[model samples]
Target: MEGTAKSLIEQTSESILNYIITNNLTTGDKLPNEYKLAEEVNVGRSTLREAVRALVSRNILEVRQGSGTYVSENTGIVDDPLGFSFVKDTLKLTEDLFEIRYLLEPRVAALAATNATDEQIEELDKIRLEIEERIGAFSDEHIEKDIEFHKLVSEMSGNVAMSNLVSIINQSISRYYDYYTSNRIKDETIVSHREIMDAIKSRDPILAEDVMRIHIVTNRRSLSQNKKNNLKKE
Candidate 1:
């Protein structure tokens, strides 16, 4: 009995997904009223509600009290999809996170130089200036905009997976900055960001790649040194 009930719920979930696809529903689009949706999907109201709750947990749907259910912003990607917060060693996590960034981001920057649309390039410039405005303050906005700058560069590459992966790593990177951000890197990032923008703006893929590589290496060095200094005090 339990097995059959669970299968039904799973089948209903698939039906809901199919309905979303068939009707061209997108993020922020409201699902039909429960009675209508259940009928359309050929499921009972209780089954449809159960399926919707399951999707909500997977970050695929959201239910707003009194408003109705809608598709979530990131579709189905959870904020901590990799479970990075479980790691106890902050420094080790930082090192590994940067390793992934180092592997993927330079090539992404190279592609952005060749592939970015004019509007995306302009948006990149806007994010860079937003970072510049928040510089020296070193507040959350500054760090956030800095992350946005990198994430935008990935999107400019015109690779959806690359963009999403960068965003995933960015969640962990944001935490690392909360503790380890240093003055040197803060200044260096502003300079490096401008250099990256200029290289991409000029459509120089090789220079953009080289510049991004330097930026990543420089950040690893700064954070490693900061970690060492903190350890010495302890």
Candidate 2:
């Protein structure tokens, strides 16, 4: 009987997850109330509560007393699923991250060129202006804007899976920028972004992909050189 109960709870939990996906519910989106969900899933209130509890423990849901159940704001690989915390070789990790970016982002930029709305392109231009205006100001806001620019491009790709993957990578790369590449935003970085913007503006997929590759490759080389220089100094 205990085993059967456990199985039911597990199945109910999975059903809830599927429901969220099917409804296109994103982080902070509220789930149907317990009563509604229980009715929809044909589960007892107790079983539904148990399933919700399991999801909460997994960082997939949150329940507020006065409010109701919500999808967790930080869903999907909540924290450092790669065990980067235990990594002793930061340079190697940075290299690995760059390798992944090299593999993913150029294609993303190509897709963005093909799919980005005019409004999205205009937003990118605004972000680019903000970045250029903040250059040499040593503002954290500039770093955030830079990250936002990349995020917008990923979203413009019109591929949810690619957008999500890029978001995950962007989180890790944000840390890298904060720690290792802070203050490394040069005029060339701004220029490269402008080139990418122009390519996308012209709706040239090949040019967008090429410039994006160059942009990432240039930064990777700069970061690599910075790491080597720091090692020499130490």
Candidate 3:
């Protein structure tokens, strides 16, 4: 607890984030220099520089060789919402991504059911409940959690190489998952997750595979729905 509190209090990155948020800063907005920021956050200039570097790695800010630091163009003000890289470049290519996930994840679920430990199943249950609790409230905000649940299942399947592959795919498709989950008026995902969980708990590999297949199909249907909605708007 002490460590957690101290970490929170000393989080220079978080202080910078709060400053940007409270000031309603936009992309391309020039932030104050390190000295000024250090004074404002009550941190040393070195600490402020470190935080800025971290944000730069996350694509939230940019520093030119000679020019002062500025908010990145892709940081959501002059670009896609929430700094979505996919939206800024290839939003229409997500169908290919979903196609691949559908091809891969059913097999992952089957393997997980066959190989996972009881403790791993418990972790799955805990994650599912957390997702359910957050349903209808910032549904898209927990995209990372949703990705994590699937990643955990993949890792628990006792197939390290496959787990690594799934992790890569998860990172790539995360933005789409966030956008997809947020746009839906009804979250059918919780039910789909429950079915997969039940199959895993029963240790029925075939059943788990079949349920997971259906879950991916359901996601495709949601994607289709979103496409249709977009057409209607146009």
- Regions of candidate 3 where Cα sits further than 4 Å from its true position: 1-89, 176-186
- Compared with the true structure, model 1 gives a TM-score of 0.91
Q: Residues 5-110, candidate 1: write the lDDT tens digits.
A: 7888999999999999999999999998999999999989898899999899989999999999999998988868888879888778988899999999999999
Candidate order by lDDT, decreasing, is: 1, 2, 3
RMSD of each: 2.2, 3.6, 13.2
Worst 10 residues of 1 by lDDT: 176-185
Error of 1 at 8 (Å): 2.9
Clashing pairs in 2: none
* Model 1 steric clash pairs: none
Q: Give candidate 1's root-mean-square deviation (CA, Å).
A: 2.2
Alpha carbon lDDT at 115, candidate 3? 95
Number of the top TM-score candidate = 1
**Pairs with steric clashes in candidate 3:** none
- lDDT of candidate 3 at residue 50, scale 0 to 100: 71
Q: Which tens-of-lDDT digit does each residue in 1-234 have in candidate 2?
A: 367688889999999999999999999999999899999888999999999998988779999888999999767555675667677776677688888989999999999999999999999999999988877565657767877889899999998877657766767776754432444546667888999999999999999999999999988888877778888999
